[model samples]
Target: MANSNPNTEALALGRGKRPKLDNETVCMRMSSEIRENLEQIAEQYGCVYGGKPWLAGLLRMIGSGELLVVPAPPAFNVKSAVKDRLKRKHSS
Candidate 1:
């Protein structure tokens, strides 16, 4: 059965949409402990009760300098060289 709510209907149609203002994507890696802490904090602020209100709150904190962002160190890439060596060995 189709959902009667327009928003739900739109979502059912694969048109689930976010606000126009939200047009960017950021990816970060963090420990599970940190994630749990953030979720707890969000709940305290009443931001975790709904769809990504916690994320919005976190973004706001970051924008206001309440949170700090540190860049991760670069990772080494050696897969291609290893693959080439393996291929040469196999072809012999």
Candidate 2:
């Protein structure tokens, strides 16, 4: 049965609309020491700045071309992920 209330209809339609993809996720394995160092840097920078320190730092590096993104192995088939990241960077 369809929802009779206008508010309910609107809410149901709103749920169908997905949010725009603005960021691409990258998953990598890192050592415990590296994770600890990153956390420390993130905390220190977060105190100095207002936003998320690690994310901010990563974005800054990517924007400045300081960070190099090597392609994932063929088995991973990560072309779409890379494309999305490029699109996101260009859009911003």
Candidate 3:
């Protein structure tokens, strides 16, 4: 049988009726710049959480209205490249 709710536009999932939202969840979209900034920050934050990505931790704290973009540590990439070069030198 169809649901008794009067506010539904139509049925969903073959259910009786769609739900009425008294307090609907809001979806917020951000600009590309904002998204990129968040991702970078999340990655850096991810580094120190027992390998738990920074994004997950940041998302958990989202309600405080504090977003960040932390600069990656300088030695991160340099060490990788140096390791690669050393490997190549040893292989040759």
What lDDT does each candidate get? 0.62, 0.59, 0.58
Off-target runs (Cα >4 Å) in candidate 1 are 1-19, 49-53, 64-92
Q: Which stretches of candidate 3 lie over 4 Å from their true place?
A: 1-26, 47-57, 62-92
lDDT of 1 by residue, 41-75 (tens): 56556665455437657766768887766754467
TM-score of model 2 (CA atoms): 0.33
Model 3 per-residue lDDT tens digits across residues 1-92: 97789766544354685567575455559875455455555675553366544444567555455654466787679447556755775599
Tens digits of per-residue lDDT for model 2, 1-92: 86567676666567768788687677768765455445554565442245444745654565777665576788875557655655775599
Native-referenced Cα lDDT, model 3 = 0.58
Candidate 2: list runs displaced more than 4 Å.
1-21, 47-92
Root-mean-square deviation of Cα positions for candidate 2 versus the true structure, in angstroms? 15.7
TM-score of 3: 0.29
Q: Please report, as a residue range, the 10-residue window in candidate 2 with the lowest summed lDDT.
A: 44-53
Residue 77 displacement in candidate 3 (angstroms): 28
- Candidate 2 residue pairs that clash: none
Error in Å for residue 74 of model 2: 35
